[model samples]
Every structure is written in C-alpha cells, then in structure tokens.
Target: MSTVHHLDPEQGSLGSQGSVDLPVDCGQARLLELGYKQELTRRLGPMTSFSLSLSAMCFFSFFGGLPTAYVYGGPVAAVWGWVAASLANILVGLSMAEIASSYPVAGGPYFWCLELTRNNKKYTLIAWITGWLNVLGQFATTGTLGYITVKHLGVMWMLANGHVFSNAETFLAYAICLLLAGLVSSVPAKRIQQFAVFSAITLVFGGIIIMILLPLCAPKLQPATWVFSSFFAWEKEEQGIPTDAWLFLLGMLASQLVFIGFESPSQFAEETRKADRTVPKAILWSIIACGILGGALVLVLLFCIQDRDNLLTGEAQGYAAAQIFYDVFKGRFGNGAGGIVLLAIPLLSFFNATVISMGTNARMLWSFSRDRGVPLYKVWVVVSKRTATPLNATWAMTALAFFLGLPILFSPSTFLAMGSISFAGLYISYTVPIALRMVMGKSFPQGPFKLGMPQPVINVGAIIYMIVSVIVMLLPTQLPVDSNNMNYTCVTVGAVMILVMGAWYLPYWGAKNWYIPKRHLQPADLPKPPARTLRAKHGGASNGASPSGSRAASVKTMPSTGSLPRVPSLDSQASPPYPSVRHPLHRSTSDDGSEMSVYQPRLQLPDIWKQPTPPRLQRREEPERLPVLREAPGKGPMVPPHD
Candidate 1:
C-alpha cells in the first residue's frame, strides 16, 4: 500500500491568526474535471462521420447562402456571389483552425482572447468587448433568420391563394417560430444532437435533389443568345462605374454574408469529443464543402435562367428557382409529386435555419455566462447535469430574439432594417478579436490550432475580408426616406450597441474586474512532480544535535543508539544519532499526547505552486469544493486581487 504524506501544521508557515499547511484532503485537485460531471453525459457520440458532416454543411450553407443571394443579388449576382464567398470561406477556415486548435473550449473567441493575452489589461478589455459583442451578435443573427423565415413564409402564403393571414401575420409567425425553436433548443444537449443528425441528413438530400433536377427541367436550357455570362455581364441601371468590377465586388460582399456563420462548430468545441483535433477539422470541412457545392448550385441555376428581366422583377419571385426545380422533376415524376419536392427545400431550409440558429445562439449565451460576463451567471451557465446543455441560455436567447423580431412582423418595411442592422452588429463583433490580434502583435500565445501558412498572408486576407464585409453589411438595402427605411442600418444600430456595451463596462464589467483566468486543468491532468527524499543538513536532526543541542530529550521514541549513547558519562562516544533542539520549556506532544522528538516536515517556497494529487486517484484523499463565483451583495466596488 502507498503511504499518504501531509504537511506538519506545527512546522508550517503561520498566518496572522492561524498556521498554514498544505491540505491533506481538501477534494479540490480534481474539481475542474468533475465540475462538468453532470454535463458530460449530454454530449453527442463521437462518430458523426462524413455523411453527417456533409449534411450539416448543406443545412448551414443553404440557410446562410440562399437567403442572401435571392434577396439582394437576384440570380446573376447570386450565382457569382457564391463563388466569391467560397474562396473567402477558405480564409476563414484557415484562421479558425489555428484558433480552435489552440483553444478547443466552449467560449470560442472570448475564451481565446483571455488565454492568449494571459489576462493582460489591454487584452482583457478586448476580450470583454469580444465576449459581449459575440453574444449579442449571435442573437442578432438569430433575429435576422427569424425575420427572413417569417417574411418568406408570409409571402408564400400571400401568393398561394391571396387568403394570406393578415398584415400582422409575419410577426405572429416569427414569434411562434422563435418560441418553438427555443423549446426545441431547451431539450437536453444529447437529444438536440440526435435531432441535428436527422435534420442534417434531410438537408443534404434536399439540396442534391433541387440542384441536380431543377436546372434540367428549365425550358430552353440551351436557348440561342442565352449563353453563360459573368455576374457583371447583366446591367440593371447602367451606372457610370464599370459593371463587371462593381458587380464582382458587390457579389463578394453578398457571398461573405452567406459564410458568416461557419464557425458554429468552433463555438461548441468544448462539448465536442476529441475537440482538440475534430473541431478545427469540422470547421474546415464544412466551409470547403459548402463553398464548393453551394457555388456550383448557384452557377447552374444562374446559367439556366436566361430571362434576366423576369428573374429580377417580382414576376420571377424568390420561388422562381423552386418553379424551375418543379419544372424539371414534374415532367417525369408527375406534377403533384414534383411540386411537393420543390416546396420541401424551402420548408427544410426554414427549419434548418431555426435549428442552427437555436444551437448557435444557445452556445454563445452559455459561453458568455460561463465566463461571468452575463447576468444570472449560475442559471444561465449551468449545463443540465443529465443533458450537458445550457438550456437556460438557449431559452433566454430565443426569448430575446423573438422580442427583437417583433418589429419585423408588424411592419414588412422594417424587415431590412432589423436584418441589416443585425448583420452589421455581428461583423463588428467579429472584427474586435481579429483587430486586437493584429495589433497585439507577438504578445498572444500560439494556440493549439494555428494557421500553418505564413502569418502575413493570413492576417492580410482576414483584414481584406473584414473590410469588404463591413462595408457591404453596413449599406442599407433601400432608402425610402421613412423611419423604417433609414439607411446604413448596420452602422446606426451597431454604433448604439457598442456604446451600450461600453456603458455597461464602466459600471459593472470594467477593465480591472473584467477578466480573471482561473486554472482550467484538474489535478489529474496536471504534470506530476519529480521524486526526492529530503535530508537534514549539519546541526540538523540527523546529526544527533539541533542548532542549540543540550542533549535534546524526548518522552517517547528516542534517537537510535547504534551510533551514540544517550549519556556521555556512560559511554565513550555518547551522542544521540538524531536530535531535536528544544527550548528549555519545550513540551512537544505526540499523537495521543505522548511527547516525542521528531523534526516535522516543512515545504520549500518553490514547491508551493506544484500540482496536487487528484481526488480520483488519491484513494481516501479528497479536497474541499470552492464556490464557483465568489462575490458580494449590493453594488460595492469590485477589484481584482494584487496577485
């Protein structure tokens, strides 16, 4: 049996009121690992496999890409917009791979900034900015999706039979959908993953069917004078600028919008098994696959549609693509079946967006709360012990998203306002971490996942994309001179949000109290200490004399007699083998109050920071559990300890 060791409290350093000794069994060494004990069971299986991965890509891509293309660019620019977006996603994938690999945790960039800067003041401020912005950014994105789903569904209902619900129909639909999505998200994480797997599979099959059969069914696919052309080849207003250059740039902006949410996997990295390797791969795989497949689908549809006039006007409608799809499949499968299949894509797209939105927003909220940035820290951050999910955070984001989306439902004109402003806010949030990384230079640590390519290349690419994305996201879709049609939606709303975040920071979440980097690894995970046997020096216990040796005495076990005798008068060499110096009035007590002379253990200052043995492997040993958050009531001023 292994013997357990502990500090001798009597010989240890003393505090003002009490002596300090290393804990023999405080139960804290494994706290980090066991803290999530309840939440671990909620994780999904590891073998998500390639099919599911591809399906996930399709779901996210369709939700993110299709809406942007159909609404702003129409068919021509939409097709080319996908191409630009694909290339941009590659850059995004590379950057994220580095960051995700380095910090494979749930909090995403917020956590990354904290670790990279090691709680430096400037970096702490940046992290604070990133955390709140990212959280709010995700909510805004969810709101945008809510807005789009309601608008599209309402329009479809209106066009079908003119018995559309009412002017308030979209708002009511959005509210219902948001609430329902929240409910789906509130289910345990394990269950949500199971659903995700099913939705992902359906999403992929739907995409393949629509893309493959729809274009083939279009009438006059190879019509005379309907040859393929670049996005810029078609001119709408014949503005002074060169069409190709302007359209290409504009298309780049549109495509970037589609690729904005690709980092959803990284946000949930902690929940992912073997995330150190898988999270980065997931981000890369999804981005590459989506870019390629989505771009191709857009290209095919663009080339097949020759009547640009009808495509742009309300005549083509957004569902014109769906019609093209039905046309191709109906000739062979029968009109009724084909029409249903064509409609399934949009229906699936709507649900896909909802699921993705719920999952991403929930993770963001969980991340923020876990870091203590948000209010209701305990409840919001608490992962269901059974499901390993932050259900409270999910529900909260859903409620907020529904509230934000209420405006769009009441006034169709405000849809663009809500969406564009949300987009701007999200991008601004994204830019915070990226900009700080660039400016912070060499101060940041290299994370587990890194952009293997040269630093200059990666940074330049990111900056370029950021500039373009911000420019496009800020521009208003329309300028109708009404309050609802206010231009530069992103800029207007984003400015207000930033100001609000800044204002909040001053009162409660300031620079000093903003970031506190707790040790993340449990004792079992920490490196082990080297072995050594401490030896006493001259004039020490082993030398048969203490520094003030006067025949140091004991009441119980005495020094061995092999090398010396207790009394000099009785033997020629009469010195104790081991001695303990004692005061004249010393009355050392042993266990059971029997007196003994034994030199108690003392720790070196260098050993103070050494990792302790974990409770799991400690046999009978255990440590005390500390409160997760240690704060006071009322609005007393907050300050970080000097350590």
Candidate 2:
C-alpha cells in the first residue's frame, strides 16, 4: 500500500504545470506500467536517433557488396534487387515501430517478447532465446565491420606498394581496426552525438561527391541499353553452377546487406527522449533515406563501369568498385589522388559504422545483464559513475569482436560466413516477436504508433520476407564449395540455439530466479490498511507516551480508513503529510547535576506505508551526538533545530 497526499490548489497547480513542462513523466509512467524504472538517461532527440540508425546502415560503405549482385544477376539485379529488399525492410521497420512504441525498453525485441507472452509459462524461455540471438548477431556485425575496414585498408596498401602482405599482417590490421573502433566508442556521449552528426553529413555529401565525380571523370560511360537492359546476363561462369536462376537468387543476397542495421534505433530507445514517437520515425526515415541514396549510388557506379571484364576477373582484389574508381579517376586526377579519394569514403564509413555497432552492442549487453540474463552480471551491468555509460559492456563487446575476427587470419571466407550469420540471427529474432503479435490479433496492446488496418497484412508480409531472407542467407554463395569456402552459417546458428536452450533447461544452471520477469504488484493488489485506535489527546494508558507531567512530545494520529490512499502525482511538490511519530530520547545526568539529551538517529519511512505501524526499532548507544538545540554566544536563548 502507498500513501497519498491531499494538496491545495496551488500545490496541485505546480504538479500540473510540471507535467506539462517536462513530459518525461509520461514515458516513465509507461515504463512503470511495463514493470521497469527509467535507468538510462533520456537525452537523445529524433535527429540523434536517426543519425545513429543511418550510420549503422552505412549504405555507402556497403557498395563493396554490389559486385556480388552484379556477378549473379548482372546490372539489373543490383538495381531491382535493392528496391525489393528496401520495400521488405520498410515493412519490417513499421511492424517493429508499432511494438517499440508500446514497450520502449533498452532490451527492444526481447522485452517485447516478454510482454507479448506475459501469461505464458514459456515466456522466460522465449525471451532468453531472443536475447542471446540478438547478442550473437550484434557480435557478428561488429566483426564484419572490423573485417571490412581491414580489407579496405589492405587494398589501399596494395595501391601504395605493389605486393600483398602475409596472413599475419592482415590479422594485425584487423586487430588495429577493432582497437580504433573501441577507442572511438568509449568517448563521452556528447562527443558520440557530434560524431553521429558528422557521420550523417559525410554520408550525404560524400555520396554526392562520388556520384558526380564518377560520371564526369570517366573517359566513356556504359550505354544505357547495357546498364538498364542487361538483366539476363550471368557474369560469373567459373563457379560450375547448374543454372542461371540459382546463381541470380544467390546474388540477391547482397541486397539484404544494404538495409541490415535499420533496427539500431530501437536499441537506443531508453536513451531517446520521446522514444515512442521518435524511434518509429527514426526507423522509417533511415531505411527509406538509405534506400533512395543507395539505389542512386548503384546506378551511378553501373553507368560509369569502363571495363566490366577487367572488374569481373578479380582486378580489384574482390572489391570491384575500387577498381572502377581507380580506372575512372586515375586518368584525370592521377593515380595518387584517385586512390586516396576512392579509399577514403569506405574507410571513413566503415569506421563510423563500427563505432555505432559497438555502442549498440554495449547497450544491448548492458540491458541483458541488468536482467541477469548473462554470466557475470555484476561486472557487465556496472555503469560508469562519471559518464553514466556502460564502459564495461563496451570493452566486453570489443573483446568479443576481436575473438570473432581471429578466423580472418586462417580463411578470408570466414568474414563472409559471419556476415551471413549476422543476417540470419537478427532477422530471425525480429520475425519471432512480430509473428507472435500477429497471432495475438486484437488482443495485443496497441501503442501510440500503429499501422492501423494494414497491420496484420504488414506483419505477415514481414515474417515471410524474413523467412526467405534467413533461408537465402544460409545457402552457399558459390557452387562446388570446398572446405575453406563452404558456408558455415547453418552450423553457427545451430550451435548458438543449442547453447542457449541447454543453459536455459539444464538443472545445474539456476536461471529461473534471475532471468524470469517478476509479476508487478499494482496499488490495488496491496493489502488494506488496518484500523488504528484513537485516545484523548491529553491522557491514555493504552497509547505509549512519556509519564504524566514529563516534557513529552505530542503525537498526531491520522483518521483510520479501510483502503490505502492513492499515491499522489509524482510531479507534485508537496510531500505526503503524515503525523510525526517520535521516540523518547534517553537522558544522562552529569556530575554537576545538569541533564543532556542523548543523540538518536531518526527513523526512515518503511517500504510499505499503509502498514499499521513502523517495524520494531533497534536502539543504539553510540556517542555521536546530534544537537537538539544550540545557543550562540550572544543569542537570547537556545534555538530549536529548523524543520
């Protein structure tokens, strides 16, 4: 039971005014309804949230993957494939926005799963699976970003020198990239906001610069018939594929990478001000904006292709776009200038993407740790006292990225395999909660943001798209796969699922106490307050008080009531007005026959306010004196302590 205070008009007016001045109360009230406190600072606005999502998507950086699309389905596949993927991703974002609006927690999809299946016996198990998969997917994303940065740097190095380095040198470069990303991520949040803004500026203006330069500087552009009508051509015939259709379908997977990280804004929901409204807009706008920008960039690159045969023959060291840039700009601007400009965009874009990925991974890990869903929760959940950021979780994610990227030293194909796993894990995690919400129909809680009548259709469409994405991601990219190049996505995803379920069900692991969400006790569910007996103010043997004629403090009792009072609005300025219940102070007589009051610490409010009385007090005899009254050197009399 809680105590409620009655306020006069002035006090009530202050409360009402405050509620209007700062609307965080509304967000907090929604969180309380979902059984959580506002643990993270709400400092991010809509632009900051959108910037982070755009940086995560990093569409310009993913131009490296365009070669794969071109190889499988020719120029037409690269264009149409991105359009189709963007449409599907928009549907996914909308469905997620509806759910995010209702439960805007840092746990994001996992928290949604918990709330959606609140009454089910298996809610904990489902939530656990969703969380782990999300973590793994984030780790894979970080690793992939690190790997891309290293590979792009290596290409720049090759342009500088004439030879390729050994596997050891490549590993060192990857480690350096991961280290740099971690350092950038550990900066203060204020700096991170600045970095996010800079990233957005660079993405927009930098993409425009490249698009303009590529067309103007090229000696001769590809014909429109070839660029737009070459849909049925298969550029890669050495893979020993049985049919063109299978190869083209495999090529479509590259489009999936363009919009992979659109869900990043949802991960920062706890930190964003007005999250219910901001997050959905951020998610939708980032995807649509990236889709438009990315599609335009692809068309510009395809039109500027000078020699398709040279690019397809691995002339760019698996980054055909780099070869196109070198060919176009080297003639007009010189090799040194062209190489620097060409490499700078991806390098900067990858670095930006890496920092955003690290931040997202740390937030997700911290949220899971707060719920006791991971090992070593005590260490992982520690927020820095100075910055209020999860420093420990940030380093943990960096260490995991380093460990995951170690395979690049042995097999370059490992990066591709990890990318596939990331695509699969994140999409599956997304599909589950949306599917559950669809199954719940009208019973599901609709948040402030809704898809209205087309919600069910959108939800079902998103699920089917995700299912196809997962299947496509797990398939081998090339025919006649060998040990080194075989896709390990299936094996990696299976291992993760098995590990998560085993930990959940195993008897040795005491997960139930920590991982399960507790059922919140609302004010109405509390026990009623007991009746109190009132006696005459001057005298009563039943009421505990000092002996008659002694200097005793008067006790004021509240009128007895059956039900606990409603809790006052949190925005109210006035504290609850309960009667003061003071205990008798002990006195000791000195040798000069002067009495001194013994010091006693005041009691604090109990956990449950509506209880009949406070808990039994334990008396202490310490000599740490608290002054009841003090007499100044020239004051008339001793003054009592001010309230």
Candidate 3:
C-alpha cells in the first residue's frame, strides 16, 4: 500500500547501492517518545547483538560446570540436568524478550519495573530495587567469571607444573583479569563489538571441536549405558542429601549458571540498530541455541570421562574437567598438548564473557544513574564524549568486582559462593517486572515484537520458573554449612536489598521523592507522535532546497474579511511536503500582493518545536501602512488593500 519512500539524489545507472541519502536509525524517534533522548550510538549491527548476548550467556561455561555435575550426579546429571535447565531458562528468555522488544531501553529490568508500576513518581521504588538487584547480580556474575578464568589459568599451570593455585595466587590471577576486562570495556563499543564476534565463534566452534574431535580421537568412549544412566556417588551420608534425587537437583546448578546472563542483550538495546526487533531476537535465541550447544558439550565430556575414581581426587591437578580432556588426547596422541591448546578456547571465551558482562553492567548503571537511582548520580551518568562509552560506570563496576573476589582469599569455595548469588540476584530481578506487567493486565502497546495470545501464559511461566530457581540457588550444596561451604546467596543478596531500601528512604536525598523516569509508563497516556501539518515541499523544491509553501499560512494573526487571490499549492504542482518534518517559518508573495495578515502578529511558535518558527512580521516603510484593527469572526486570514 505504500512504496513512495526514500528520496534519491542520484540515478540508478550511477549506483546499484541504491539511495545515496543517509538512512535514519530505526528506533531514534521511538526513543524520543519514550522520554529520554538517545545518549548512546546505535552502532551495533545484527551480528554483534546475537554474538554479544551469546558470549554473555557463556556457551564455553559448560566445561567449567562439567566437573561439578560429574562429581555429584555423574554422566546422567551432567547431560540431562543441563537439558532441563535449558528448557526452564528458555521460558524466562522468551518472556523477557517480549518486554525487551517493546521497550528496548538500556536500563533493562529496572526501567521496566518503573514503567509496569505505572511510572508515577512514588512508584519508582520498584525501579530502584530492580536496578540495584541487576547491578549486584552483574557484579556477582563478573566475580564468578573471574574465578572461572583463574580456574582455566590454573589448568595451564597444572599441565606444566602440577597443582592448582593457592588462595593468594587465585586472588592475584583474578586481579589481573579484572584489570584487563576493565581496560577492554573502556574502549569504544565499536571495538568491543569485534571482540564479541571472536568470542562467539570461539565458543561455538570450541564446543564443536571438542565434541567432534575428542570423542573420535579418544582411545575409547564410555558406554551408552554409563553415559545416559550412570551416577557417580559422593559420600551421601557426609553430605546428608540422602538420595540421588536430591543430588540431581543440586547438579542443576551446573547448567543454570551458564544460562543466567541472557539478559545482557537487552542491556545493549540502546546501542543496537532496530533495537525493538534485534534485541528481542538476541535475548531469546541466544539462550535456546547456547543451551543446545552446551548440552551437547557436556554430553561429550561425559562420554570421555576416562578416570571416574581418581577424577574427584584431583588427579589432574585438582581440576576434574581438565582431566577428561588431558586423558583423551594423552591416550591417542601420546601428549596432552593438543588438549591443553584446545582447552584454551573455552578459557578465552570466558575471558570474553568477562569483558562483555562488564560492558553491559556499565550501561545499566549509567541508565539507573540517569534516573537519580544511585548515589553520586552525576558521576556515574557521565558518558565519554571521545568513545561514547560509559567509561566511569565501567571502571566503578570493575573496581567493585575486585572486592567481590577478595572473599576468595578467605574462603576456598569461591565458585559455590558467588555462583549462588549470581543466579539468584539476576533471577529475582527478572521476576519483578514480569510480575508487575501481569498485574497490569498485560495489555500494552505492542512493539515490533509481541507474543499475542501466548504472552500471558509465557509471562506467568517465567515468573514461576524464576521464583523456583531463586529458591534452588539459595540451597547449600554441602551439608555442614559453615563459613567456607555455606551458600551465601541469602546473606549477600539480602544485605544488598537492605542497602537499596536505605537509599530509598534517606530523608531529602532519597529516591522516594525524586525518581520519576517512567512518567509515560501507563500505556493509555504514553505520548504519541505529532501529526504532520505541512505538505508542500516535495516537487516544489529540489535537493538542498527550502520547503515551498506559504510558511505564513498558519500564522496566528488578526484576520480580515476580504478574500485574497488564490495561491498555487504544492499538491496541485505534484509537490508533497516531507513526511518527517513540520513546516518552517517563511513569507510568500502572491501574484496579487497582500499582507499575510492585516495587523501585527499575536503569537509565534518556536523553531525548536519543529513547530517551525512563526512567520516573520512585515514592517511598513512609512510605519503607518500597517494597522492594529481586528477582523470579524468567521473570516479568511487576509486583508484587502485600501488603494
């Protein structure tokens, strides 16, 4: 029905690339309608969105989790537990994706909370809490990834010398990683985009290389009976879990940890092209694809488990998963060098995850500060003019992550500790806005992406899945819950929420009175785009020409009763005003000259309004020619000359 768009300055014979005019960024106007102007560049192409999200989802994390899954529930738990976790996260991803597509803002869940709560000034409490949760969750994720990177680095040290790192060494290694990720994240988003592509390829191909080559190159594979049904039993009495059923539930952590960061894509939405459509696809599909790939990866690692009895006893320098990769290549190739080299693939992928996670978290922090939700809002809200990245926020989160890992020097079980809260914080934050939307009746303005009839069902399912996951994440993996082995999810996330509440009610400076970002949250009252009024610019003017028409046509001045000579219209002359802009201020002369208005002008709209500044007033040479007389009602806005 509509094919008359894209004005051209050149002919087709000169170019097959088509229109030479600069293309409009897809969601810029929509963002203006959302209240805040676009502060970030829409530089991320389609490939970067998907890859960046996948990298955050951590496809390479399967190798790291393999050891834990095998120790508790063996091959069966490692393979199928991941499959079950994938299905659960996919539901959550879909629900979040629908909302992400609708909003496509950088604040992600917290901004959504503000809107779904009806955007009133008092209701910003929901957004405040949600933003704090997301930031804490992201910090936890960065810590977890840092430990994993050190673990991978430990694998290299183990292959060369023979033992895992001491607590001090682990801290030192993680510090190096923190500094590196912070430095990388400080670069412009454009360069970080290239790293995303590399990381995604490494993760997908790294899994493929291991799954295909390790199995074929191994001396032998574990039987189907063992791979599908076996359970490597730990000391059930010591742990007090008492049954394989409970242990399998415990092993679900292996997969759920890898699935938690799919929301990263939505954090990058403001910087992505056609964000309304692209971000939702990135959020949803990144999980579905990563889950399937990770399941295959864990399945392959299970079949290649050559030493079941000694695997738990740190036979391969205390890294149980690295032992499987070493034995496979050592059996066939007479050296573990190939295995070590290949293992670096996933390790580097985790490094990429670290950088990207820091980047997304900075964006969320910047957005939260923009709404005055965080302390020193002015400091964090500043974006770098040179790189256009949130450098201040990036460095702040990176420094805080260094502290989160400091606990590792005191506690041995850094993985189980940070892992618990990482998943819990993200899952709980994700649940809030989805629940608020459901309470609002789920009937809002649809964006480029919407679930239609299935939306409500998916929303409910995501909420349930997240709530259950939060509970599971809080459960202690070990029985004798002490300082070292306890699941600190409750303590860490609970303390964070209390601090958030303190900021909320802190007298005059609190967010309670000031947080009002989602002013247009209620769908019924959301601002609509203004209708176009000028329509005489197209054929009347060529390229680089001013719009044609009586810019004074709509001037609000005193009207006269006489009919003026008919003027030429752009429409009759095959001219149409540019659809994207309003009429500008100018004066036009007719064949039979007469003033646009008899008396002086009364009101003038400003140019900033697009509004097209009001037509200029004319001053007579003698200063007596113009009159101040008012015209009668129901008359055309023109005057007859008194010659």
Candidate 4:
C-alpha cells in the first residue's frame, strides 16, 4: 500500500517518499485536459485553502448570532443547535468537495453544472441560471459583511461616546468600508493575502482568549445540567414563537450562516496545487476547525451567563454580544476592560474576512467572464499585464457589492433581515449542481478526493439540508410578520431567478447568443471531430489534406471553442510524430479597439508549423523501368505506344 504524501508548501505539491507514479505538473496537465490552460500560479497548499475558508467564517457573525439563539431556545439551541448546523454544513461541504476535487477549476459551482449537464442541449440555459446564482450569492455575502462591519463600528462609537450613529453616517461609513475592501481586493498583490491570514490568526487567538477568560472571570458557573438541558424561556409575547421547535430552527441560523461560506475556498482551485486533494481537504477542515472552536466558545458562553435579566431587558447597546462580554468582565474585574479588548477581535475578523471573500468573488467572476457568460465579458476577462490580476473583474464585483448595500441606508434592518437572501442564493447555487450531478449518474470523471460509497448519501443529504435551510431562512423569523420584521428572501431570490429567465429569452439581445462553454471532450461528438487524422501512403498530400499528411497546417482551422487536438507522442511507433504547431496571432475587435491574442486551441508547440519538408521525407526520383512485355511479339510496339 502506498503511504499518504504530505504537501510541500514551498513547491506547492504533494511529495511522496517512495517511487512516484505521476508525471510532473500533472495538475496543470489535467487542467488543460479539462480544456482551460493554467493562468494562476499554483502555489497554494491545504493550509492556505484552510486559511481562506476560516477567514471567511466571520467570528463576528457567530457572536452576534448567539443572542438570537438565547432569545429563541436559550443555551440548548446555542449548544445543540450548533452541533446540528455543523453536521449539516459538513455534509454540504463534503458534496462540494467531491465536485471541487473532480473539476478543480475556478468558479467551480456553475462550471460543474455546465459539465454535468453537457449531454443535454439546454446546458447553456442551466449554466446561465447557476452562474447568476453564484454571482448574486457572492454579492450578497460581501454586502452582508460590509453592512455588519458598519454595525460593529457603530456599536463601538456608541460604547465610547454615548451617541448613536445616524443611518446616513452609517451609510457613509458602509460605503467607505466596501470601497476599501474593493480597492484592496483589486490590488493584485500576493503580499496582500498575508494580511488576510494574519486576520484569521487574530480570530483564532481571540476566541481562545474569550474561551479561557469567560469561565475564569464569571461570578459563578452554571451547573452541567443547566448548561446542557435547561432552556431560557423568554416572556416577550411579541417574539411570536409558537413552539420550541420553531424557535430552535430560528436560533440555528447563525450557525448555518457562519458555516455556509466554507465552499468559497473551492474558488481557489486554480491556485492550489494537487487541487483535487488540497482544495477539498481545505474545504472540509476549514469548517471542522471553525465548528470545533465555535462549539467550545458556545459552551463557555452558555455556562458563563452572569445576568440573563440584564440581557432580556437592555438592548446591550444594540449589540447582544456586547452585554455578555461586558457583564462577565464587569463582574470579576470591576470594569469591562477585558471585554473591550475582546470586542476588537471581530474588527480584525471583519477586515480579514472582507478581503478574503472579495478575492474569492473576483476570481470566480473572472473565471465566469472568461467563458463570455458575463456582460461586458471582454472588460471583465482582461488580466492586468503589470499586476497579473483580473483587476477589472475585481472592480466590477466590488461595484455590485456596493450597490447591493444601497438598501441598508433607507432601512438598516432591511439588508440585515435580507441576510437570508445570501443564504438562498448560495445554498441554491450549491443545491442544483449537486442534484444534477446525482441525477447525471457518474458519467463525468471523478477526482482523487471522492466520498466513495457515501458519495450518493452525502450529496443527497446536502441537497436536503440546503433546500431546508433556504426555505427556513426565507420564512419569517417571528410569527406576527409585518413590514418591519418580514423576510424578503422569497421576493429577492425569486426576482433574481426571473431576471435570469428574462435575460435568456429576451429576443435577439438576450443570452441566447451568450457563449456556452463545451467540455474538452465535447467537440469529439461534432460532425467533423477536432482531432482528425489523414492516413496517406508514402509521399504527398491526400485529397483535401495538408501536403505533409498531418494537421500542422490545418491547425489554423481549429475553432477556439474546441479542445486542443490530441498531440501525437514523439516516441510512438504507430506513425511518425507530427510536427508541433505554434500559437499563431489573431486580432479581434472589441470595445477597446483591436487586441492581438494567441489563436486557440491554446497549446504551445516547440516546432514551427511553417518549416520546409525535412530531407529524409522528401520524394526520391526513380529510374523508369519498362512494364514487362507480357506479349513477347508486341514488346517493340508496347514501347512505341506512348506519345
């Protein structure tokens, strides 16, 4: 049996101690085999992937959400509900990881959808729908994070100055936060990523500090029974929770939302080496890491609740988490100094997660735009020559995120309540492809990181979980649903889907003409295959064939949409190897005038196609031999018959 190889961080690949079976840069080769050339540097390992996922987890969301749990089902939901949500997320992550391992492409969700449905003619329409789901999901996520960042800043100001920040002031602050996040994302520097990693480190350590301090600083700890079995019954009738079960589901949203974005790491597929293995591992472990810590943190918080009375009555200065922190610190130390320092951790988490998420979003957008599925595709697809980044796509993503937050200014809670919109978009994006993959029944290639026998179970379970989560999130948080407390998820998510349909059928101007990406092997099903051969004898060109009896000259006719022709092996014995083809230049007119690009099938060959025939293969002159005179008497006449 072969031993598992550890990742070599510097080289960005797995290093086996024993004899190797695969060739160098096999991941890169596989990517080409999948029909796209590797453009991003494949230097990320499992650790980086984990960092990305962990960074996107947003510790602030967990803290803010804990109160929601307490108000609904108290310590019981905060503790057990977290466990259920984590398990559900793991199932979702497992399903996502399975596909990510197989495809290992940027913007994997919709790409997987396109590939899984390749046999169907309506794949374009399906992919178009899934693509917007991913885009809108990512936009809502960034918007949510940005809006929350403003809320955090507002809370800090209120605590320090005893003045509430106005909605307009909050709007201006929100704009600046998003703009900064966007600009930072567009910079296209590798070093910028390290800052994000640092932010993740801060979150982990901050959680540790909070965990250690919560019990030590508490006036007294609750009994094991209270921590595990007891539920806080809220007397407020306006909450309108009909039953404990309903409240429990509502309370679980924080855990569910915090866990949802773990799939974001799959967007880093191109950048991670051994991506089939590394990315999936990254995705699974990231959630596990967050879950483990989040669970412990929840336990500590539940056991250390000093005053539930202060919590139910006061608004906690408009932040539920702050009361918990301040109350614990004030009880032991006579001041909330420790709590003040702890509050700042989420700020670091905010900065870290915002950049990490936006980067993921930009990469995904860039990949989609590369397929010409996005509007202004030419602009979004361009890579900045100097920075080697998809800056245009980054800026475009940032702009949409900015606009998505516009509703926040008018009614701050609208955007917050509409948080379910993010969940709907993200979970829906995940559900369709996984469901399709299941229905498609294993025709597509499997990657190294498969779930084996449990794959079917995992995929289906994930679908159920996500569908249920979306439906739950779209439901009203409280029963007395009014305009102020209503959930807008149904309207927003439906509206987005309707827009996608309209775009697809919008007469001549719609996405009917949008480029539908085909599989690397798909064009083989076409009338004239991409890789055709000419079996000519000895010397010259066959009818309608190149003079060399090979495809070197006909390379010009290969369409950009198809995969590169099957390259002949140099050492093959079946036939002499064909000479290589160069990347010939072509000019295409765009809004930005004429730009030269390497004509596709996108392969780079060593030998030039425009070379003279090699001497060995040249035709040889032969001495004319007279046809044997079968008729002995007519031998002389047979020679004179020629004019």
Estimate the TM-score of every prediction: 0.69, 0.77, 0.78, 0.78
Q: 475, model 3: CA deviation in Å?
A: 1.6
- For model 4, which pairs clash? none
Candidate 4 runs further than 4 Å off:
1-23, 232-238, 518-643
TM-score of 2: 0.77
lDDT of 2 at 394: 91
What is the C-alpha lDDT profile of model 4 across 396-420, one tens digit per residue?
A: 8788888777777787767765555
How many clashes does the backbone of model 4 have? Answer: 0
- Total colliding residue pairs, candidate 2: 0
lDDT of each: 0.54, 0.72, 0.71, 0.70
Off by over 4 Å in 3: 1-23, 232-235, 242-244, 414-419, 479-485, 507-509, 518-643
lDDT per residue for candidate 1 within 1-643, as digits (tens), equals 1111223432221121232222111111111221211123314433342222443334333433443454443454575566666776677567666666656666677766765565576556667776777776677777776665665565445445445566576678878878877877777766667776776666667667766765666554644233234334333243223444454555455566556566676666655654556667777777776677677666666555634445434322445554344344444455424544466565656656666666777887777675567767768876666666777788888888877776664665565565664555556655555565666566654544566447557766866777677776555444334455445465557676677556556666554454453433332322222123232223434334324754233222223212111111211211111111111122344333435423332322234344556455577845897545545679565565555
lDDT of 3: 0.71
State which candidate, 1 or 2, has the greater lDDT.
2
Error of 3 at 559 (Å): 18
Where is the poorest 10-residue window by lDDT in model 1? 563-572
Clashing pairs counted in every model = 19, 0, 0, 0
